[model samples]
Target: MSQALEQVVAELRNSLGTIGEIVGISESATPRFELFHAPNSICSQKVRAVLAHHNIPYRSHQLNIFEGQTYLPANVRLRLMGCIALGGGLVTEHTGSTSVSMGGCDPAVVPTLVDWETGQVLVDSKRICFYIDQTAADGAALRPAHLQNAIDAEVAFVDNMPNYQMLAGKPPGEDHRPESRRKGNGVGFAMSKVERCDHYLAQFADDADLVRGYSAKRSKELNAAQQLFTPEAMRAAYDKAEAGCNHLENKLKSGDDWVVGDNVTMADLYWGVELLRMKNMAVESFWANGAKPAVAAFVDKVESIPAIRASVIEWPGAMY
Candidate 1:
């Protein structure tokens, strides 16, 4: 980690319990890992599912991303550092999911992991999930040696689903999310992000990186603020998500219990979150209308796992 990242982590650790709501397996002394996450985020759910699945012990530093928790000064710095470390001064554009995929990184997001024992700060849900799996207790991992390639492809397929953008803006002339969720977080995140960006732009006027970071976030938010009426953009995202549904349906038609096989792997964990997010988005028409029976059953099966239930389904306001 860079000196800046280490310093930010140090500052964040000082305000842990006060600013963040703690959950997960609490250890008396310092836990081996500390997670900074938001329950509303799909990425956070993915990492939480991995940890819960393997029964790994860690401290959960929960944030309210919709309330601008991720846009707070310290979090902005932490996420900014992670982005810069990934070889970017700041996030200049959006292509796919903010925290995953081959498109680009979102400078402001949640579910950052601090591996205290190893002095490592992990970013990105996909990377974090794999890291947790490989370093699992007794070195036990989810992916079988021979199935590694297949499982990785499945994971990547889930990563490509535009869950973030879907929530940021829904389909034009039609909202598929359940009525209960229509009044949820994603609708106002752009506004929250704007407030934080403006505040930091004035407060961190002298810090070039911080200023640029906040400014970049503000620019993205401004674009998203107008995205609500943009049929083209929303339709494009919907098409992508629709494709994901079709892909999963095809994969599950082979009579597999999980994404890759009967046993759960990193792929299964990721798809669990992705599938649930899709369902909650109320986009199930693609697979729920007696068309993709296998996909529907697989979604229920994935959620049936103890870890997924406790980590995702039970998480209050976890998905928008």
Candidate 2:
């Protein structure tokens, strides 16, 4: 092993105690949870928010998506094992790694939860959030059937709309263009070169019709985003998003602090992270720069929650 890998393993051994027995290899069937996540990914943020809300303690394996380090080669996993060993071994019985698959409709996405005990791997943030809500031990409960449905709908809506907007902004042309053409700016530029290459290969395959359709869909979404992003456009999208927020605010306005019924649920955790993004992106500005009392109060209410605060706090040099 490389020096770095050795160091990581040494660290894991120190932290985990007997758990380090599973580092190199072990027959024990203890289920451990490993989360592979990118530091700035929205979906990753959402998952982390849920984890925190549930107060579920698990080891984190940071993947530098910006650096193209999402896939775990055998060697890298070995290094991770080293870290887990140093962390004093796995503490949970349901041991396995989870990630959000950002590969678009593929089964190999991130935000996935792996149950080593059952050898089950689950993808999809909504599903993962629900699982955590149902299984977590000493944390807040996700209850009230109606409230869960509302929260799920809101999360799904918020999640899908941004992708549509992002897709809408691409340059128009044949889908078989060079990688440079496909990767324009913003999130695309920041994506690891490996991810960009994979995206090009996956999305711009031999099928012209498929490529065209994908591009067209993206163009529509980008156009919508453009129209919705301007000072005037911002107002429209903000109004829509705020309606979602207002749904939560109204709930909170009834003297309850959380977005869902009363206590913080997966819904609040999911929305809290998104709102943090919006606040940072100045999305609320379209609706009076968040100066409006209702919006400010709403932001204040979510931000005040301890779990939300921990999950969405600004990282150093995060604003680019």
Candidate 3:
């Protein structure tokens, strides 16, 4: 971490004991990285599941995204630094919950990973998970070379779905999430994201990096605001996720237990979280429910995996 960023993380952690705690014990003399994540974020869940599945160790700092902890100036600065490192620019569009899913760097969000010794700040859950998977010694690769192409396809498939947007806005006729869990209970923050970013934008107007970061985030929210909860937009989001599940159902009908190959791979890891997210939202009506026994069974099997279970199913912020 940069000297300035180091102080910021230190300050954030100092008060984290109340709202955040580390998830795993460090396995090496030197820690690999520190994760700034949120317990309920689908993206964060994917990363946590990867760490658990591979038995990798990390310092986990949980953020409450709804409360805009991720929009804090320090966090914004860190995310923007990550954006620049990846050659990404200001956000002018938002088709997905996070920019990473839409082929851009995220200047605002949780689950940012910062390396310990190198200070390499990694954003995007898929990149972070693949980083941990590929860098491990023998017998630890999640997307092994021979399976890289296939695994990547599966991962990208999940990334293509509007996972976050599906929850952000619910179609009254189609949404099945429990009443208390709908709209405001857990996923309404996007409605106020622009205003929230503005609050911090004022605090760091002079800090060039902070100004750019806040502005990028505000732009992201502004772009998404236009269609956040319109009935058409909400239904479209649901259809997208359902169509994704249907595609998986067709793949599984071939009698394979996993998305690709015979054994569990990174593909399974990504789909497990995706399925879990839909399940929690009660949004599995047509594709993964009783009518689609194959897909339903697959969802059950993946969620039961010990590692995935701990990482997401029992996460503190998980909705029923």
Candidate 4:
């Protein structure tokens, strides 16, 4: 094993205070399904909902990301530093003749799926969710045949919130909080868990270069986000959210409690999580302040589902 991979394995083993568990999981099961994830990870939560929705069973390996576990060399080599094919497969092997660079990208972001039955190891929440929906015969169809386009559109909008970058510190947002306020409260508490990643990672002196680069980039992002709270930025955020709310309102105006049609679909799931995030950030005032009564009712309906509420990681203010 490479030093980085070895380090990750060691950390994984150490965190659980056990030996052979990681390797054992890899080796013991024939046609096994495994999911590597973190509890509070949004993507992870999304995948879990899909899995729960379908009643698909898999082994869960919840990584303690706050302890620098994800930065371990193995995780980088396996998860992030790999070639992800559009449909499903993740190829991490490096060819001697070609240079494959995945610098500064943490692939261990969570909710990685390994389906031993199909010999498929997939990363990315959307892809995994798609895989589950496509492969599983049971469960309510998340992507209904008639509503596919609408579902995709809703997922696109929810996942591509530019203003989300203002709060999340990234385009495809990851949780961002300051290390000093890890234990403190008031606002942005959700970010506290994700922010400690850099500090924990710095203890690995061998990865100093990578650590320094990440720290600098994080600082830059935080500074940029500070500016995103400006009146103009707030207006932009409000407008964007209003646009989404309007779309949802029109969809629900038909008297369907869900986004696309009478039944819950991927669109519902995507917006369910997105709405929860907005609520967490106190941005759901767009609904509460009487701007979109339809949307408000729609969100309430989505949240009332046992699968959505139980499967999704409930953030503060997420529940009704």
Which of the numbered candidates is closest to the native, going by highest lDDT? 3
Q: Which scores greater on lDDT, model 2 or model 3?
A: 3
Query: How much does each candidate deviate from the true structure in C-alpha RMSD?
Result: 2.9, 12.1, 2.5, 8.3
Whose TM-score is greatest here? 3
Candidate 1 on 253-278: residue-level lDDT in tens? 77766778778888888888888888
lDDT of 2 at 180: 35
What shift in Å separates residue 67 of candidate 4 from its native position after superposition? Answer: 4.5
Candidate 2 C-alpha lDDT tens digits along 77-145 = 333333233333221110011211222222112444444444344445666567767776754566446
Write candidate 4's Cα lDDT for 133-156 as tens digits: 998787478997778887877776
Model 2 score (lDDT): 0.47
Candidate 3 to truth, TM? 0.91
| Cα shift from native, residue 1, model 1 (Å) | 10
Model 2 TM-score on a 0 to 1 scale: 0.57
Ranking by lDDT: 3, 1, 4, 2
Q: After superposition, how far is residue 62 of candidate 1 from its true place, in Å?
A: 0.7
Better of 3 and 4 by lDDT: 3
* Global Cα lDDT for candidate 4: 0.56
- Point out where model 4 deviates above 4 Å: 1-31, 64-68, 81-83, 86-108, 162-235, 313-320
Q: Quote the positional error of residue 252 for candidate 3 in Å.
A: 0.9
